[model samples]
Structure formats: structure tokens, C-alpha cells
Target: MTKRRGERPPVPEALPVPVVDAHTHLDACGAQTPEQVREILDRANAAGVDRVITVADDLASARWAAQAATWDERVFAAVALHPTRTSTFTDADRAELTALAARPRVVAIGETGLDYYWDYSPPAAQHDAFRWHIELSKLSGKTLMIHDRDAHDDVLKVLDEEGAPSTVVFHCFSGDLDFARACVERGFVLSFAGAVTFRNAGALREAAAWVPADHLLVETDAPFLTPHPFRGRPNEPYCANYTLRDIATLRDVDVADLASTVTRNAERVFNLGDVVQSQ
Candidate 1:
């Protein structure tokens, strides 16, 4: 059966254990009001995606993401000016983001790496913003969530030049096997998105399969890369379950075991011990 391009994929069976969607964009997923955010989280929770980190691409979305984290116990936020939106980066913007990074529930400063694929932001501005974000992550003692797209070398170079934060994650990791190994070597986490499930993404699957359990994570990158067989459809956090199962299959690991491992990894990566205990 061919699913319509505009359709939303049906939720897959619930996982044997809960896991976290390491990165997603609630605002981009059409979640505006508190009710909408709750509904999204409720749907994700039902599928064993108990927690999600809604990432921001700009100051507006950053504010919304930080605020949305408070709407539900299951939701957390990552704030930053995305690489593509950093063309006009300013000190005022940095100050605001610095303040947001200190929020208790804003667990990461990110989605702020290099993106050579998009011409929206100049390379120079992106590098400057990425460096500042690295410092902010260190200062705030939060995980640094990165958004690397077709700029792997430059991304690595900048992080090296700036000295990456203690906890750095490559959101929607688009790197190949060597890049994956490089990231693992640096103690940075690699988060796979739905794109890893695509039939044409053999290299990505290889990278996903090879990454160590402790350094691995999963995300939907929703409203963007809906997984295979549902490509072009609308995506939400619940879709992460499908991506997780596929990754487990790729790694030849039991789904439940992989779920447990990734859940634990996410908890530690985001410092969600208190949140998990509260639940």
C-alpha cells in the first residue's frame, strides 16, 4: 500500500522498554500551544518514547522550546541559533541564548553546527556561532547538540579549534564510517535519525551499526526525515520507535536491550536522572 505523501504514518507497536528521542523540533512539528505540545508528548509517550528533547533553530523557536519543556514532564529543550540561521548572529542574541541555557529543563545548547548544504547562513557566521555555542555549552554545563549537514570536516575542525564541551552530540548524524569513528574517538555521541532507515542509506546504516552502544542515540528529526516506507509523510516524535527498531535490527541487537541501552545513554547524556526518577 502506498501511503500518501501528506499522510502521517501509523504509530508502530510500543517498544518493550521506554527510550528517549534525543532530538526533535516540537514547534516545527506544529506544536504551538500547551495543548498541542501535550498532545504530541502524549502520543510519543504512548509509543514508549517517554522523553523528547525539542530543539530550536532560532531565537523564537529557542524561547518556545525552552518554554515547551515546562509543559510536560516528558519534554525537555535544546536552545540555539541553527547554523543556517546564524548569518546575523549578534551579542544580544548570544546573551539571550546564554540566559536560556541556564534554564533547569533546557538540557542542551544546540542544533548549532555547520550546514554547507544550506545557503541560508554564511560559513563565517556559522563558525562564529558554533564556537560561541561550544563555550555556552561548557559554561552552562549542558550537553551540546550539533546539527551537521554536508560539512563534516569543517564541523570537526571548528569543534577542535573551540574545544568541544564535555558532552557533545551530533544530532541526525550524517557522517560516514570514518566520521562516526572520529566522533566515537572524541567521546561524542552519535544520534541517528530516520534517514538511517532508508534503503539508500547503506553507509549510514553501517555507521549506525558500528557505533558503540554507549555512544549511540536515536531521534526522529521529525517533520523532516520520516523513516522508510513512510517517507514524505508527516513525522512526529512517536516515529522514533520505528527508527530505533530498525537500528537495533541493523546492529543485530535485541530491540528491548537496545532500547534499554539507548534510554540509559539518553538519561546520562541529558542528565535526566531526576526527571526519570520523578516519573
Candidate 2:
């Protein structure tokens, strides 16, 4: 009933310039070992996707992501427990995440935030965990990576009440033009994934095109949200080129120029100087 990544579309051609995958899941993509991680990065690099921000959904995956970021110079990480999995959350979980968030290579504290679409976690628990994560992001001084899905209003409410970190990213941004304008007005960065390239995502594309260059970002959210002409396939960092190219074409800018802007945004937001060198 489901298609494995191997059964999905093949990798596309390389981009004109290197860009960072604003969000991804190397572990889910089957990069379980250091060698596997390197191999994946190699394929990504060949496609001009030189760096990535591997995201975590739970504590175990967060640890995996943190360790994976060290596997290569191109891999950075985000640490957090996803809102959908907060049903069994405890103080111990927060304690462990707090420690993991302090890791030097852990550039962002996120893939957190609310998700009303999934009923796995109670609304109250998800809200509480989101508040905790916001505190963690503040305490650790790391960028906050938000995973908003059908809960944009609550997500914004929490951010307003708790106050957001210095740099915040709406990973896999699914908002409409009005929502996009609202986020941009607050200086939040939006990372568009493959959904933007979908034919039915015209509103998303319009919102993306309206975003200021500095506030725009591109990601694959891999093994999922695979770009058009390959929507059913497993996504990887390498596939980000397709989304990048799409956005560039939509905005009528050079792909290289867009890449440079997004790469710089990723570098500054995550402070991944080790993985993102001057180019």
C-alpha cells in the first residue's frame, strides 16, 4: 500500500549552484550508519546540494540526527520531539532534549510546534510541549524550527505568547498567501518543501514568490513530499534542486543567485559554519 524510496523516482540533474536542504530526515531515508550517511551526502553533493539540516521527530531520532550531523561536513542537525509524538512525553524527555540541544553541531531546536491534523497527541499535551520547546530554544540560543500542519493559528499564538527565538523557520511551509504575509511581517523565515511545486499548490507558490529573498528557503523533507514529476517517490537532499529550480523559475531569478541567498540564510539561521563554508 506504500512505496519505498527505492521504488520512487530517480534523482534529478544537479543544480547550477549548491544549496542547503532546509529540512530533511537522513535517518528515515535509511542513512542509519556513518558510511550510509556519507554515501547519501555524496549523492546529494553530486546534485549540488552540499549541505543539509537533518531534523528529528522524537528523542531517539534526535540523538540519531545529532550524531549524523557529525558524520560529514555537509550534515547539520535539528533537535526536538515532534508535536504528534508528545502523548507520552515526560520531564525526563525534556531533560534529555535539553542536553541534546546543547550539542555543538545541533544547530536548531525544532521540528517542534503544534499539529492538529494528527490526533496522536492530545491538544493540551502538544501545546505544553510546544511551550517547553520554545523555552528550550530560548535557553539554548538555537534557532527554532517549526513544523506547522493544520495548526497555524495556535502555532502563531504560542510564538506570540512565549516569544520566538532570534531566528525561526516554518519548515515545510504550507501556508497560503495571507499566512505567508503574516509570517513574513514578523520576520519569520519560510522553508518551502516539495508541496510548493505541486500543481494544486498555486496559493503556496504565490506566497513563496511574494516572500523577500532573505526570508525564503528550500528543503526536501525527504523520503516524503517529493517534488513534482516525482511526487510519489522518496525524497532526498539531492532532490531539493528541483524545488529550488521551481522557486527560482517562479521568481524569475537565476538559480545560482537564489541558491546563494538560501544558503546564506541557512548558514546564518543555524550557525552551521563548520558545514557551510564560504563559497
Candidate 3:
């Protein structure tokens, strides 16, 4: 049957081992209330995606993401103003973001970096915001989650100039193999999203195949980038399971082994040990 446009994909079969959706936007996925959040997570858990890191793109979402994290033991948060939205970033915004970063369940500072694809925010503003986020990550001792879109060189340049955080993760990594090698060489973690499963993402697949287990992670980036066979559909955290299966096939590794490795990587990067234990 031809699925209608914007239809949500059916929950996939459970994975041999559970994995985490290293990045997603629960708010954008229509999970605002505690009941809504649990309903979404329950679907994901059934498909073997046991935990998730819900990322924010602005102050409002950042606040929601942090609050949502506290609501569910299986959910964590990354707070930041997205690069494209940085044009209007203010001191008041910084103060609030700093406070949000300190929240116990806010495990990362990010979804911040360059995004040349959209002109919503000027480059200068984006650069300044990205640098500030880098500092915030260091100060808070949390992983830095980057959203690099069509400005890879500048993203790395800015990080280099400001000394990257001890733990760096490129969310929804869209780079080719060469760029992947550059990030890996710098010890930055590369997180593949649903886009990696796209048929034309050959270079991305190559990079996915080459990344070492410890440096690799997977995400759904839900409410967007639905994986193949269901591309263009509405996506939620549960879809990370499908992306994980594709990556496992791409790497020619056992699905269970890959799940375990990425789950461990997610736990280490996001400091999710206690969260997982409580779950």
C-alpha cells in the first residue's frame, strides 16, 4: 500500500539490544505534556530505542526540553539557540541558557553551529553564538552537540579557534567521508541521522561504515528526516530504530553488536549511566 504523505511509519520490530536516539526534538514531535512525552517514548521503547536526548532550537524549546528531561528518566536534554536563530540572541537569552545548561538532566549544550543552508541568521551572528555555546559546553562540562549544515569548514574553524569542548558530537552529521575523517581525527563524535539511510547518501554511508564504534552514534532528528522506505513521513523517536538498522547494515556489523556499541557511546557522551540505571 502506498502510504499517504506525512503518515507516520509503523513501529519497527524491536532491536536485539536497546539503543538511544542521540538527538531528536520531542517538542517538535508533539510531545509537550508529560502524558504526550511518555506516549511518544513508550512507542520508542517498544521498538528498542530506550532513551533519547531531546534537543532545543531556541530559548522556549530549551526550557521545555530541560523540563521534559526532568519528567522522564529515559529522556535527556541539550539546550541551545540554533545557529539560524542566533541573529537576535541577547544577553538575557544567554543568562537563561546558562541556567538551563546547569539543569541536571540537561546533558549537552547544543544544536548550535553553522547553517549556511538558511539565511535566517547572519554568519557573523552565527559565529559569535557558536563560540559562546562552545564556552558554555566547557564551563558546564557537558558534551557539545553541533548542527552543521553546509558550513562544515567554518564550523570546524570556529571550534578550533575556541578550543572544542572535551566531548563534541556533530548532530545529524551530513559530511562526506573526508569531512568525517577530519572530525574523527579531531576526536569529535559523528552522529548519523535518518538522512544517512537516503539512497543518494553514498558518501555518507561510506563515512558511516568507516567510523569507529566508539566515535559513532545514531539519531532520528525526529519531526524531520524520516529514514528511507518512509522518507517524507512524519517521524518520532521510535524511527531511530530504523536508522540504527540501516547503519548496522551499512557497516556490515551485527545489529545487536552495533546497538550495544552505540548505546554505550550515547551513555558515555551524554553521561546517561544513572538515567539508564533508573530506567
Candidate 4:
């Protein structure tokens, strides 16, 4: 007798991996459990996304991100109080964050920086927290993942004044070509996200074209900023392909080469050599 459909052999996995998503929010994207995270990462892997940096902006989400990273080989965590969430930061919170930053799975000190858009937290609080995270990065010797929104000048000023860490990444880079040139000159990495794929993102594309190969990276920033063709849909780590393809087109290079180069840049910045093994 013929075997039941349920007993059919499993299909082999797809090949030809895409670029790594240097920044994502798998934990904040409603993938709280191991099973949920596995499903997200599996989808990403199927889409040729070899790895992801799961960033958390608050204490609870930071803990969850760390746990997810520890449990999954594909997920690396970046823990810090995001600019919007700095309202609740306390001395105890700083101590806890310091301890968490020392953890093996925690690779960076952000999703932190300036955001004058929402002002969910006061500007002063955000600045104070940003400085605190900068110090934390210096102490831990980890990379700094910055999140600047409508506050580029101030962000740059603070970073320069605080003597930014050697490895600085501007996640979801929203600056112009001039800003990008300055960042390149300063040896800072600029990570493009889904927003770069939007039709109205000519300025972002121009910046992408100008970013040095060694300082270019990509991210999904999932559950938000989904790329074109999926712009309005809920984003996930798997959608990183669109950003990578768009960036490659802007840089006038083969997609594979761009992907490989950005992946190497990310690994270098986040110290993910041990995690991005197969990529």
C-alpha cells in the first residue's frame, strides 16, 4: 500500500544564502518563545538569511533577547535601553545592563542613541542614557549600535565628545550623503534597513552608494519598516533579502559579493566570528 502523505520524506533545504541581517528585533517582534524564535530564524534561513542580530531596547526585552541568543545559534543579542525607553532607566537598571553586557551572547551595546521624533522619553533622559551606554560599551569593549532619528548633529556631537567606541554602527541609517561621508571618514559603519528599499528613499540610496564597502551593513528591523513589495506587511528577518538586493543595485555590484562583504563587515563590528560560522 502507498504511504500516507504525512509520512512523505522531508524536503532538502534551499541553498545560496543571502546577506546577514546585522540588526533585527526577533524578540520584540512577537517571537518570545524558543519555538517562535526557531520559526522566525528558520524562515530567515530558508530565505538565505544566514544570521541575525536580535536587538532589544528595554530591560525585559533585553533579557528576552539575551535568552534567545543563548538558546539559538543563529541569533546574537544587543542589549541597551533605547532612546525612547530611557524614561525608566535607573541606577539599578544600569547595573543590570552592565552585567548583561558581560554575557557571552550579548555582542553590542544598543539600539541606543538619540530620537527626537517621538520624544517618548525626554531629550535629557535620552542623552543621559546614551552617554551611559557609550560608557558601557567602552567598559565592555563591545560594539556600539546607534539609533539616531532627526537628531543627527546632536548624536554625532555626543559620540565625539564621549570618545565613541572603536566599533560604531549606525543602525537603520537615515542620514544623507554628506552625513554618510562624515561617518565613513570617521570609520563608522552605516547599516541599511528596509527603509532603504522604499521608492521615496533616494537620499538613502545615495548614502548607500557612498558608504565604503568595509563600513556597509544591512538589517531588517523587523515588525517595522518592511521593504518594498512587502512595505505595509509585518516585517521579519526573512525580508532582509530586499534590503540587500537594493543596496547591491545602488552600489553597482553583484548581489552575492555585496552580501558577502556586508556579512564580513557585520561579523567584524559585532565580533560575531564564532556565531556566523556557516555563512
**What TM-score would each prediction reach against the true structure?**
0.97, 0.95, 0.97, 0.92
Q: Kindly report which residue stretches of model 1 are placed more than 4 angstroms away from their true locations once superposed.
A: 274-279
lDDT of each: 0.91, 0.89, 0.93, 0.85
TM-score of 1: 0.97
RMSD of each: 1.6, 2.4, 1.6, 6.5
| TM-score between candidate 4 and the true structure | 0.92
- Candidate 2 lDDT score relative to the true structure: 0.89
Give one digit per residue, the lDDT tens place, for model 2 in 145-264: 999999999999999999888889999999999999889888899999999999898899999889999998899999899998777877788999999999998999998999899988
Candidate 4 per-residue C-alpha lDDT over 1-279 given as tens digits, one digit per residue, 9 for 90 to 100: 223322312212332445678899986578878999999888888878878899988999888888898778888899999999998788999998999998887899998999999968999999999999999999998899999999999999999999989999999999999999988888899999989988898998889888889999889898788777566667788788777877788788988788788877877888887544523
3 against 4, candidate with superior TM-score: 3
Q: Which candidate would rank higher by lDDT, 3 or 4?
A: 3
User: What order do candidates take by TM-score, descending?
Assistant: 3, 1, 2, 4
Tell me how far the alpha carbon of residue 173 in candidate 3 is from the true structure, in angstroms, after superposition. 0.5
Model 3 residue pairs with clashes: none
